[model samples]
Target: MTITIYGIKACDTMKKSFVWLDQHKVEWQFHDYKKAGTNKKDLQRWIKAFGWETVINRRGTSWRKLPEDTRASMDASGAISAALQNPSLIKRPIIEGNGILEIGFDPAHWAELF
Candidate 1:
């Protein structure tokens, strides 16, 4: 199974996830949203698979820093746009296997897959 991990390299959770994958000898590809650029289609797919509430990182400081008006006006498109511009707004460690999607790192959750 091919796995694609989408997140910034600096995230601790992402680092841990990567380590776990490496230790398990899981072959995977890393896509840094900042350098790779997040597209609306992929964001939409993730939102559909995981729900916007699950994929959006509202707990992050980046989300907290957004203006109230901006936050209030965000619909699906707006949220995707925001996520594309500010990748931190996305939940870290979004992983996909083929077309199957998983958000965030929980060893147990991933263990079920392999």
Candidate 2:
């Protein structure tokens, strides 16, 4: 399976994920949303696979920085729109491959998936 990891390159969690993947010799492509930008279709698919609540990084600074109204108005579609507009709003190190869509960085979870 072709693994594609999506996130900003400088994220600490993303760094850890990269190291883990490298240590495991997992061949994968890094999709830096900050540089390449996010695709609405892909984001929608991910949100569909793992609800907007799971795909969005509400704990992150990006989410916290959003206007109160924006945050309060968030629904599935709104969340997807926000994430597409600001890639940082999406959870880091979203790993996609082999019909799997894993969000965030959890070594234990990755161990099982890998």
Candidate 3:
């Protein structure tokens, strides 16, 4: 499968994912949202597959830094808006390939995925 990994370049988990993919001889491309930014369509797709709870990184500093009202008021559209405004609010290292869609960096899960 042709793989594309979406994440911030400097993320520690992203670094590990890079190494894991390399070690497994998986040829992949990086989509650094920090540079290129994520779009509403992609966010919508991921949310549809994994649910908003999985697509959004609620435990991250970016989420924690949001105003209380914003967090409290978050719904599907609100989450999409927040994530579009700040890509860091989305979970790191989302791997998409062919029919595959996954979030987070778990080496064991990745082994099974590939």
Per-residue CA lDDT of candidate 1, range 27-88, in tens? 89999977887888999999987787788898999999989998888777878988988888
Give the lDDT of residue 34 in candidate 3: 91
What TM-scores do the predictions have? 0.93, 0.95, 0.96
> What lDDT score belongs to each candidate, Candidate 1 first?
0.87, 0.91, 0.92
Q: What would the per-residue lDDT of candidate 2 be over residues 1-114, giving only the tens digit for each residue?
A: 669999999999999999999998888899999999999898889888889989999999999999999999898999988988899998998998887788889998888887
- The best candidate by lDDT is 3
Measured with C-alpha atoms, the lDDT of residue 23 in candidate 2 is 92
Task: Single out the weakest 10-residue window by summed lDDT for candidate 1.
Answer: 95-104
Report the candidate with higher lDDT, 1 versus 2.
2
Query: Candidate 2, residue 49: CA error in Å?
Result: 1.2
- Residue 102's lDDT within candidate 1 is 86
Off by over 4 Å in 2: none
Instruction: Please give, for residues 1-114, the per-residue lDDT of candidate 3 as tens digits.
Output: 679999999999999999999999998999999999999999999988888888889999999999999999888788899999999999998999888888999988989888
